[model samples]
Target: MIKPYTNKAWYLVLPVFALVAFSAIIPLMTVVNYSIQDIFDANTRYFVGTEWYREILNDTRLHDSLVRQFIFSGSVLLIEIPLGILVALMMPARGPGSVVCLLVLALPLLVPLNVVGTIWQIFGRADIGLFGWALNSLGINYNYAANPMDAWFTVLLMDVWHWTSLVALLCYSGLRAIPDAYYQAARIDRASNWAVFRFIQLPKLKNVLLIGVLLRFMDSFMIYTEPFVLTGGGPGNSTTFLSQTLTKMAVGQFDIGPAGAFSIIYFLIILLVSWLFYTAMTHNDGK
Candidate 1:
């Protein structure tokens, strides 16, 4: 007969559970409460049910921002994933050179998000910024302040510069973790570099690529600080993503109920998309 099981160790998790409840659950409940009520003042709050959600769902502003958000996040994933793989492949396998390359590549990730935005803001200025100056010198009319296309390009370029290293580093670690025996077998078989990489390394990198894609998608989808600091959602609202729009509604306009509703919808959208990404990436893994 099996002995009676004891799960005393589970008790140790109580503090963590309590902490999550206090930090996340309570705040989420508060948002839900606010979403369902229209507040006139501290003493006057009317129960409005799902009116706020309905309004938010129908808002054209939300539609535009959501579209822009998808485009930006999609572009980021498409560019960064393959570029990162290439960078990892080109990186030295081992030695002091590898250490130096890693440190250099990691430098951009060390910078604060706001600081990265500020750097790009100054760097893209048409007055004295190097990039702006060079473009003007080449007789190119490149003013991000007045051009929506320019602003979009600048923001996308900045994101690539800021976040590509993270993908590269993750891919590099995955490449290094691969066993030497696989490479030895390929070499013994006189396999071409393309054949070895395609048959051996590419297959092994699937999990790592999935992680990178998910992370980049999430981060790009929720991105705010960098673009806000750089563009201020200007050039005709071309770069105004969902987060910035929500911030404007909640903080700028002080629309508490609608903002709360917007936040919940945003959270649900992110949750759903992230689940889709995970499912699509892992669907074939079991086979």
Candidate 2:
């Protein structure tokens, strides 16, 4: 007779579940509590009942930062998604070159975010930096500290350099999952390169592309460390994103009431957008 079914392994996972609840859920509830209150002291918090949220809803600074964040996140997805696919497609499938290519592409991801920013900061400096020296020699007037355009360009370029490898690696994994039979069939039919990519590769890679787009969008929208390190949201708010704005409100200015409200709203927006993306991507899959 067959043994009765059991799920005793679930007991092994209970400790992990408890740790996550203690770490994430507890702090989240604390934020939710703070978001609805006005505190004059540690023990003198008065229930404000969404007043902070209303104020945040009316804040013009938040509006501006939201718009800028949208632009940055959108640009990141636009650049990283297509470029990632192209890079993955060009990567070798086997042999020593493939190992070398993987290592090279992974180097950027290995660099710490703060270190990446510091590297670009020194690299972009106009006086002692190689990039600056070369640009000055060429008479390009490339000062990220003085011009908003230059600051924006530098920040965007830095982000692309730092994060593009993640997208490439994700897409590469998706590409490698396809069987040789598909390529053999394409070769048998004398398929053009574009046709093969369009019909076979693109279709197979769609799921991973969706994952890359969603991940990049979420991370880029909340980006703080690199830009904060590089420009300090400098040149008069040119590179100030939502996370920077939020951090300033929360930590820099000690506006806990508004910051808590701001964080909750921010979390909700991300949740809503992620839901939309997930729904749209999976809508036709079941059919």
Q: What is the C-alpha RMSD of each candidate to the true structure, in Å?
A: 2.2, 3.0
Query: In model 2, which runs have C-alpha deviations exceeding 4 angstroms?
Result: 1-17
Model 2 C-alpha lDDT per residue in residues 1-287, reported as the tens digit of each score? 99898999899999999999899998998889889999889979899998999999999999988998889888888998889889999999999999998999999999988898899888999998898778888999998888878888888888899889999999999999999999999999999999999999988998998898889888988888877887898788888999999999999999899999999999999988888888887788866
Report the C-alpha lDDT of model 1 over 1-287, residue by residue, as the tens digit. 99888998789999999999999999999999999999999999899999999999999999999999999999999999999999999999999999999999999999999998888888888888999888888999998889999999989999999999999999999999999999999999999999988999988998898899889998999999977997799788998999999999999999999999999999999999999999998898777
Error of 2 at 167 (Å): 1.0
- TM-score between model 2 and native: 0.92
For candidate 2, give the lDDT of residue 271: 84
lDDT of 2 at 182: 98
Candidate 1, superposed: residue stretches over 4 Å from native:
1-12
**Which lDDT value does model 1 have at 253?**
99
* Cα lDDT listed for each candidate: 0.94, 0.90
